[model samples]
Target: MDIDRRTLLGATAMPFVPSVLSAAVSADDWGSIAREYDVTREIIQLEHGNWGMMPRPVLQAYRAMIERVNRDTSYYARRGMAGDLEGVRAQVADAMGVAIEEIVLTRNATEAMKALILQYNRLQSGDAVLYADLDYDSMQASMQALATTRGVRVMKMALPEPATRQNLLDAYRMAFDADPGIRMVLLTHVSHRTGLVLPVAEIATMARQRGIDAIVDAAHSVGQLDFRLPELRADFIGMNLHKWIGAPLGVGALYIRKDRIDAIDPDPAEDPARTDIDARVHTGTPDYAAQLTVPAALAFQAAIGGSRREARLKQLRDRWVRPLRDMPQVQILTPDDPAMYGAITSFRLRGRTSHDENVELARTLLERHGIFTVHRDGLASGSCVRVTPALATQESELDRLVEAIRELAS
Candidate 1:
């Protein structure tokens, strides 16, 4: 006799069972995992792309570390903190399939990417650097500063709104072929504006063949996607642990390939002779508690695995987006292609693409329907409201968002 899948899972849920997760799990099973997150009950949160709320286990670990640091203070600072930091770094490096020598911790993606951008030593006075409009604003500012101080040219492009694989590749190809003076390109692994996942390895290879380097801004992609350093085929990258990794806030990292570490200038705050990746970052008086809790966050993510989490987040995004795609006056920014996106998506009404209009729409969603989203600017096409769902978000919560958009769009 054959039994149902849920029944089979229930039968195996015995004492001392570990949290083994599978992407094919039933809705009830997904909800069971969702319960482990301590999200707010007052609002239907659909803006988790900014920062992820830590799961209960990670939060517990964070609180415990805080207490321990408070108890010992200077002693831990002088002695125990070094060993704990090394252990966390080893776990993070192991998880990403990278060497510990190549990674360094920072406050967040802004700090990490800024360090990578401002410290790159390849540009000449007239050489050009390329970046897209959808790149993070802070990183863009750092690139602009390079142009002013170092006298390098800055070129910007806009991604196609309804982007396709071939078109996306073609755009970058044309850009590189058109300009030999462009020596460095900044790429976003997954766009924060519309959740469009660029083909990083392909673009990076294109840049390399032309003697150009690529710096990846992976703020929203690391824990949300399954690929790692070697897979991206880039020499430098900046990542966020607080966003999708569900670690405590104020944690991020940067990666410089072992062979290419010397190409970037060291942080002046540190000894100039130090060429290690850590020398690129100089976060004074670090958040020792959060740094110590990084291992627990890594452990929690390891239990569920990156592939499973990626599948689950994509599933949730599709569920809400599929029903609303055909609705008139609503334009979905993220394409339906699974390979092109993860959890984050954005939408705009037929003519509501202006900054004020999009902001008002987001306000209406929150005030009228109790669904929360954020208005994002800097899309070359126009502004839109970004909707992001966390791993802990429920189907019902997304359904409410769908219904509210239906009502608003009508």
Candidate 2:
């Protein structure tokens, strides 16, 4: 029997049965898996980095939870919701390989990261914090804000354009050596601008040796990459469930090592005396339905298996990227190294680095080819258009994207 969206959604409750596939599933098997997602037919969607779409089963579960929450209303919120949310939190913690006491739920990664950045208590006057161009824009702003709030100096550097795992590590090591006053550093596990995966664990370990705390922004890495949260070796980390986890929008998580909880100040509204992980971010009244549907999303992801999912995503990425790697007119920002990239990759036309040029390039792909992509700025080298393939994206659609790039480059 062929598995399809209807078949999955027909289940009375969300199914937790794992559908473990071999390292590389066959095309027909992938096609059957793709059928589990009901994507729009209007445009070829290669822009899933913003957020992930819930598979049909997860969506059905989300709708059911929404209705249930709406019907039960305050009675449920005031009575059993707390306990239910704790169960959800436990599931998330277990998946992240952390204790429940070390993780807390938040609206999104930005909220969790903002709380970590703003509430971090170790900085003093003249202390310096380091971040690179690849960091998220909002996070960069928050790091810069420390200059005013904490009387710390904010230092920004640009990662090497053609980055390598060793050079990337050396860059941070050298930066730390140059500036001993650096008290904290912000690390983006995967670059949103160019889809470059940093050597986060190595750099975090380097920072720790120098007595500098590292705060990792893992918004794009958690579910997309097959790694445990502890692997990054950071004391604090923030991640999004909505992006790669395929959870409903408005779900994210914050992780703080139990021993380092005191490093982060409690939320202003939270009582200082009660400074547990939960007190770190006080996001009052989140989307309860979305939070409740997390288990369904996890079950859906688990069924696919993390290693298999990562392989599939990277396979999709390489389909287009490998073909264009040597094209004279195209500049692929990410290197060929497997460790430095994942599903997301960005490319630039040799001479088109301006913001408007890249924007127009993305526009041409959408308007002319019926393909959707996004233009990202903030890389020191220049602007580029990012192509991100979701689990549901067809190989034929990526082939179309490759053809479009070839024609455009010509």
Candidate 3:
């Protein structure tokens, strides 16, 4: 099973080469596209928000990389690894419509974000940092760490339930106006808990006008939604490839706007000359095979097309959620606005707020109905079970989820 780097580069470069099964599927058939993944049929998986399952092509590429690296060992590491990584980074940049110099590959979004959060040097004493409760828990802890280690004030607010575009924008407006000392706001492009897509470009523009900086946590949005870097208008962004891009696990990226790179002080441990976007965050040797497979992942995603994948994911979400819309006992957390959501959504059963209650609901869904989902906490309203449908999710599986929710809620 050993594959050399040369073979991998040559094979993935020809993006037209479809996986064996997919080669027979016509352009109009999405079911054939769904067959690319070796998904299990024993249980209906609706919790794809946590981690994406790689398609057969990407997985094969990963295996090939593993074999190549394992066989070549340090010889490959010393010579070919750097160029391969740069190729992967270039693929990431191309996929996002950004320049290669502005992006760097990291182990995951959490690592990328913490690097920016910890290295940012612009915050002064008495300056406040703001983030919503919906931001990633690790990122919130990093913000809190800044409060203790740097002596800056930390502020957090809950996004409005049933969020609308204007209300979401206005909330940030008032928060900035109310606290003139607020120097930075951490905006989650899509809430993992509720799947609410905030108006990031509007919020970023407003923050810029107010002399505030924003670091976007776009861990869930980039691959799920079709957008470019300029659309967000944020100088600093941390995103994950593993979640939506179908990249192998342990691969993600960080973007520091070319002009704004200096705002994040260079890593003190690195050489002063290496002071560009790549120098801002340092994670010791990552899973190189996983990183090398990014190009193949990006290529696979491109073959499917971003808009088509996004549309399919949303269609799956709607298939499950639309049926339960009128269920009195079910409280759908995501708003109805198309602009506000993608594949992720959450539903709370009436009177289910406690940790145990939410966990039980998720457990029952799996144990009784063969549908898998996750329970999420940290909302102002209450706890909920989050359902995230991947592109490969079948209509029958979604219908099964709808039936399960209907029975459980009723």
TM-score comparison, 1 vs 2, better candidate: 2
Best by TM-score: 3
Better of 2 and 3 by lDDT: 2
Q: Judged by lDDT against the true structure, how good is candidate 1?
A: 0.85
Model 3 poorest ten-residue lDDT run: 12-21
The total number of steric clashes, by the backbone 3 Å criterion, in model 3 comes to 0
Each model's lDDT comes to 0.85, 0.89, 0.86
Cα lDDT tens digits, model 1, 1-410, are 12232321221111111243333143337886787787887999999988989877677667767877787898867976776688778777887889999888888988889988999998899999999988999888988898986799999999877898788999999998888999999999999988999999999999999999999999999999888778999999999999999889999998999999988889989888987888998999778788777776776677777788899899999989999999987999988888999999999998777999999999999999999999999999999999999878999999999999999998
- Quote model 1's TM-score: 0.94
Residues 147-263, candidate 3, lDDT per residue (tens digit)?
A: 877789999998887789999998999999999999999999989998999999999999999999999999999899889877899999999999999888998899998989988
Rank candidates by lDDT, best first: 2, 3, 1
For model 3, the local distance difference test gives 0.86
For model 1, name the residue pairs that clash.
Answer: none
Candidate 2, 1-410: lDDT as tens digits: 12344433333234454343222243337876777789898999999999998877678778878877898899888988888788889899988999999999999999999999988999999999999999999999999999999999999998987898889988999999999999999999998888899999999999999999999999999989999999899999999999998999999999999999999999988999886999999988889889988888887787777898888889999999999988999999999898888899999999899999999999999999999999999999889999999898999999999999999999
Worst 10 residues of 1 by lDDT: 8-17
TM-scores of all candidate predictions against the true structure? 0.94, 0.95, 0.95
In model 1, the runs with Cα more than 4 Å from the true position are 1-28
Q: List the residue pairs that clash in candidate 2.
A: none
